[model samples]
Target: MLVRTAYRLETGLREAASRVALRIGWTAAVLPYPGYGTQGRARVLGRVLLAPTATDPAARRGVPGWQRLLTLERPGVDVVVELGGSRRTVRSDEGGIVDATLDVRMPEGRATATLTVGERYDTATVHVAPDDARLGVVCDIDDTAWVTNLHDPLRAVWRTLARSSGGRRAVPGMAGLLQALRGRYPDAPVVYLSNGPWNLAGPVARFLEHSGFPAGPLLMTDWGITPRAWFRDGQAHKRSSLERLVEDFPQVSWVLIGDDGEHDPDLYGEFAARHPDRVAAIALRQVVPRPRERAVADDPPPDSDHDGSTAARAPSGTLVVRAPDGTGLLRGLRDALGVEPDRAGDDDVGW
Candidate 1:
């Protein structure tokens, strides 16, 4: 939330909306606080605690309990806030996706509200094209880029807590790597696609901004992805996401970096195969976790680890690549985005 802090220091946190106005559509329940930090950075906070919307007496009295509040995230992000007698779902067996129509006396009176799945960002999602001439770097966050994750789960959890509680922790050599990228393309903004979901938004943002991981448009998933949806999108979604980014801008070349720990290699490989013209290089990070640790922690199984013998076969004629560090690939953001360097270098960019 460096951005928010800087802004408050300049213009101060807006007190006018202290009571918490606005209803987040059940699909996206996020309160947008412009500049929660200082200067032009975002300082997100858990201040906007949310609950089921209050209603008139007649509306409140007439409610159904069977209308399951299908929980999307299987692990349950933290705690579920009761709907105050509102219809609730029994189970949302999906990864974090469930569909349940609300039952209300005045059915039309039912409105959607977004619960805090727990994440925040400073950059607006950027649209990119795979074949742009400008440099486009896709960096992984775990050990390859730094060393925040890929360690003892208990210690990692504690580090996460410390960030929320105002503790500062940094991954060695991460900021320098980011600065290195910045030096390469001072104008082209970077995007981070992490396996972490919206649940870690607040804490993750706190860690990255302080540590330096190109705090720009970060593409993260909501923990609420349905099991079926997760299965369906596993490799396809990530590949499509990167491709869509390439298509949206159409003026950059992609430098894909990720660790062999997850599906980064697979996704990057698929993108490279289908749009071979756009992808320049692929880098995989080498993790040092013990095999016992790997077996215990690799929940849901990382796709890359399994692809050692078998490869994902996509219709686009794309094949996945396994890597140890993302830096091995660098066609440049200009080539990845398909944008003119001189032109991209002059645009106003904070996202």
Candidate 2:
């Protein structure tokens, strides 16, 4: 009883602190824009926002949702971004978020982007990997890579807030398997698409790095109401992300990796159906939400791939592999396309 009361008191204190912080007006920040671009002339995209200081740092630390609510938008602010020694000016929308894509031309290498909102400045760096990276891996982070209990949002929130960096566990051999999926290509990119709020980007990225997963761009969503939706939809965010990726890198063929914990299968399947030629394969991690949900030993449950059929041929010629875990996933990948995933850091990069 005392423990419960203490927790409630702590929560109340945090809420009060957050409210006080929100009332302190807005600060400008340049989000961690995707630092990746192609050779010749490439489009660079990022956002500028006027939000409470609580948003980015708290989100980076994986703080609870209540703290995140302190972030409110300040719109219509003119911002200037410096990219590759050039300056591009853009204005924020009514929601206090600015989406700007500037054209950059340079030889393939790493570049820094700087956003200046009056006197405040924020910077991000991105590498321009070769455009011929045909084999791309797109992954979902929640139950698929990091062990977040998406079955219960409250539990997930608690775990996220309570754990520090390196607290989250990788799903067994999933990290190694993801690295191996890069195949023989020199710069095969692995992009993470999650329904997780943008504030958690730092935590998620830290988790990935600590777990030995390959470095790739993390495409996460902004929490709360945006211009488009009253309550943001994960499905829509993922779909839009996929669309943008394909549109941006039409030359790259993608392999989608996700879990059956939620809508990954349906969304990935829908993507495969729409862009048959672009998707190489779909790998799904079979997860049992609750331990009690597992089948009794006396009567084994149905297999993840429908009665021991591991690979299914999608109408668009994409191979769908459903496996119990990462080991099974590796085996399925080998069977489907003779792919041998490489070790992590073969390219000596954290990005």
Candidate 3:
């Protein structure tokens, strides 16, 4: 009885200290969405945080450091964002997110937006796929880009918390495939959509850069409970993002890429079905399900059984790739977009 009482006291003290630390460490943070639109009226989206210091030890390993058990939304804070010569001010929502539009005259190329909250400033870039560009690529991060064992939640979290960009391993040849896609369509845009928590954005961005992948905008999400749901739906996040992208760029045809480990197949399939004309191709990575996956699963048969035969039903041009280290994706894209040899002499290589 005495030991139990002591443990309770210790736990209470730790909670109290954590609360105090959060209160003291709160600061302004801006999470900017990669804004894309036409020159006349481009839209900008971002979140403003009276952000508390992230205390999770996993942060050092590569998970988002700005995320915490408690979210302190600073509603009504005024934010200023600038692009080229145009500047605009908007207030954060009750959730501390800012979704605003700005008028700017940007010449063809990647454009940068500078967001400022008092002296704290951060920059985010947006891609403007050329008017005549034929294809766009929407990519998934987990099993599609690299292997993070989503089937085993604990193992996934440990890998994220223990690895740095250099320490982390990207799927071999994945970068080459993306780079080659850019080579095929010089002006095409590649957007990364991940259900991974936004706190790990820094590491993910670094990993992409180090791997020589083409540059584009990242759309990530927060990983805590919200008012309507007990837990966040990652599929829901990807769904909305895809909807927004399709709506925003009506003229651009998209090639979807993801792994079979999660809901990418279903989500991409559904998305392609709805917007058949806009979707050019859908590529899914074939992942071997682990023992834990079998023990905990009911629906969605394992990869070997599913075999992506069902994906063909999702869209007219859908196919599953083995993701044989990246060759599978390369082959899929080759069939979909007509893979071309990358020329180092040409300027198409870099962002």
Candidate 4:
């Protein structure tokens, strides 16, 4: 069960979100939706839905019905009912709200796709098709994307409080790689899922946009939760957040990128194993990529199959390409995705 705790957003940030909420859906998880990015209205940064775009019929769009946007990260998920079926069906009005389902599948030949939206967990399976396509680029910020010198995370934390965070330099050529991904797949989305908190958005965006990093969707945790709080601490359902992203974008394959310092490799490994095909490639960012960690990403610990991390779905094709600098990870995306394209629709590209 989702225990909604009262999180204390920094007064200043809370005020900003309240003002923006009138224009956008500025809740913590995915905010600024439906307004404000562009003055009176923010660009529809992105919307989460169970169905794919019907405009692209060949693109494997989900049947139009009442489906809410569920998790889109490590265990990518979504739900839809196929009534026409060999299926099941539901009806909705134009603005993306579902009133009710018209009918249930009574015929024996009909197989309704009533994929239920269930409890938020480490891994939840949802409808996914192989032929479908979308943009795919995984991004990371911090010492890798920028020279925040997060080798000492505390210093980075202080820099944010001081609001001098933007003063830090950008990693060499990192922006070029992001630009490259943007240039290559304009329609595909690039997500920055960082350990950074909500307060860093303004400064971080300024630094990234100023230095040339493509400014797109960003995912950050709130600092409001105390570490002792089981879910909120540093371990809030980040994997769940990651799952939400992947599940939301059906076409986009995974181009995982991150540093070795924290659990990026481990997290990405678990994600890759579950949806190997979704993960086109992974570039672990680092100054000197350690051999041991690389080994872990490439070949997770033997007990991974039995471990909670890997217990989600059997691991997938998590190719951990070592990036000398943050730029290297970006460069590797072009290299790996180009040479060996995603399995097209092969969901099971296992270890």
Which predicted model would earn the best TM-score?
2
Give a tens-digit lDDT track for model 1, residues 82-201: 121333323222233222222222111112222233342111122221222266666665555445464557655544434341354444444554565566666444666665544444
Residue 281 error for model 3, in Å? 0.8
lDDT of 3 by residue, 1-351 (tens): 555565556446545654665579766667666666543556676776554544322234433333332344455778898887889998987556677777665665678887877656667675656656667889899867777867778877866666655666787667877887787787777889999766566678778888887887787776654455545789999999999888666777887877767788678777876787888777666665431221112234424322122223232444434444455456444544554534354323322
Count the clashes in each prediction: 80, 3, 2, 32
lDDT of each: 0.40, 0.66, 0.65, 0.45
TM-score of the candidate numbered 1? 0.46
Q: What is the lDDT, from 0 to 100, of the residue 206 in candidate 3?
A: 75
Which is the better candidate, 2 or 4, if ranked by lDDT? 2
Which one is best on lDDT? 2
Error of 4 at 160 (Å): 2.7
Question: Best to worst by lDDT, what's the order?
Answer: 2, 3, 4, 1
Error of 1 at 224 (Å): 4.0
- What TM-score would each prediction reach against the true structure? 0.46, 0.76, 0.75, 0.54
User: At residue 119, what lDDT does model 1 achieve?
Assistant: 42
Model 4: worst 10 consecutive residues (lDDT sum):
34-43
